[model samples]
Target: MKNQTSITSVLLMSLSDDQETISVLFIFFLLIYLMTVFSNFLIILLVVTCAHLHTPMYFFLGNLAFLDMSCSSVTAPSMLSHLITQHWSMSLSECIIQMFFVIYFAGSEAFLLSSMSYDRYVAICRPLHYSQLMSWGTCAEMASLVWSTPFLLTITYTICLRRLTFCGPNLIQNFFCDLPHLFQISCTDPTINVFILIIVGGTVGIAAFVITFYPYVRIFRAVLRIGTSDGKSKAFSTCTSHLTVVTIFYVSATFIYLVPDTSNLLTLNCVFSVIYTLITPLLNPLIYSLRSKDLKAALSKALHIHRLHPDTATRR
Candidate 1:
């Protein structure tokens, strides 16, 4: 294939080609996007407004809610627009920007999940030192690290991606601009890019996974030693929601990133991408609200207060 320096855009593949099917999908995804944003926003709002929820756990949860909303927003609007207009082409710059945020938010979320797990471990395994270990200052530092570290890594990844030549076919096989898809289509050899992805990305992912789940081992041991059934139940309840969210996020992400990208697996990759990008955000709020009694109680109290003092709520 001859190199074309003027290749400035790429075509994104839509899930369906039929206009009728596209319309149905557009409506379905639009609803999911709206619900995802609203629900996650509500979680953030609840965490911010509820004084009783101003603990380390809720602090990390609020950050997760924000990340979920931001992460979903990175792709949902673009995908919805493509579905509605049946326009699957995006400028190279736009695609690169989207890819940058995708990596940034995803990496940040993995680290944030690890932070949350540490918070739980402290609460369960080191209850006597929970306050000191998970101080507001310490939590702030961890949150800063989670958000900032990924920006650097994503910048490095994007710089490497920018150096690659995309002079050949510019049709991306999936709905969004992901690294693997981009690497696959590069006219130039992507051996360096692949190495960075595997070395840097893999190290971060593995470390985050270890940080996020390894605590559960100690947590389980601690819970087992609790004398009362109620004690064990309460301890497990605190972890169940975070664990569920972590499992879903890591499982989907691992499948998409770790598995070899072959022609036969492109469709499967897209499906898993949808799960991580769209479905996970929608499920996060549901999982937290349904499994977390504190969040439910906080929502109830907020609603009751709103009903009683509509004027006050409006003014605020």
Candidate 2:
């Protein structure tokens, strides 16, 4: 790549520089990426085709599946390609665009998780009013808010980052063009960028965390109030999958962002980045669909329908 800007391009660090390790890691990540796409797509297919899953819960879940695929796409494919060639290079513009989407989808996922939590809270805590509370319009509005706000905010920071000139070593010590990694290579002061990340991005993270978990606090209380063991069991079952997902996502996110890394090192950040960017997306659909009898039934039904008429999809 030719130098197009103050710095023409940046070199991204591979997960491993060793050829043998790169080969092994390439295969491992390829399998993981493929599995993540397939699993999330399965959830989407089941949600779209199954009439029984058209409720608010599954609607949010379908959106999540789409986001998971997108988030994984942002980094996994690029990382895989770089691993194979052992050459991780991207032009300045490409790096900025990649970072934008990474943050965009990540922030959107955070808000979407919170939205799903609210849906669960309504369904379990106020069962009588779930329909009234989570009507089609309400859900649509929430979805729109979660998706759009993140894009705008991410754009703001990306543009801020773009304005910063890069005149130093163009090597980024991470698999992808993460904001922090980008900050490390900038010639201009990144104090404002850091401020936005901490104040704006941190605020978003905290808000997402509070929204996502606060509902569970009430949910737990309501679950305990149930008199029958079966009722309590049923209530807990409804939210456990979501709770598991939330815990994984938030813990990874908090470790990455909220708690400052005193060392400002890239090694630890890379590990956590892989968790949320790749592992969380890979696990989200499983968490939602694994223990779900309805999802299983839907999947079975879809397969059965496909077996009955292989050409049905083509006709549609």
lDDT for residue 167 in candidate 1, whole number 0-100: 76
Which candidate ranks first by lDDT, i.e. highest? 1
Q: State how far residue 280 of model 1 sits from its true place (Å).
A: 0.2
Over 4 Å off in model 1, which ranges?
1-3
Which digits, one per residue and each the tens of the lDDT, describe model 2 over residues 1-316?
Answer: 1353578799987677688888888888899999999999989988897899999999999999999999999999998888877788989889888989988998898899999999999999998999999999999999999999998899889778766888658988777887887888887889998988889988877888899999999999999999999999999999889889988987887777655645575578788889989999999988877868899899888888878998986698
* Cα lDDT, all candidates: 0.91, 0.88
The TM-score measured for candidate 1 stands at: 0.96
Q: Cα deviation of 201 in candidate 1 (Å)?
A: 1.5
Q: All predictions: root-mean-square deviation over Cα?
A: 1.4, 3.0
Q: lDDT of candidate 1 vs native?
A: 0.91
Cα lDDT tens digits, model 1, 167-214, are 748889888898887887788889999999889988988999999999
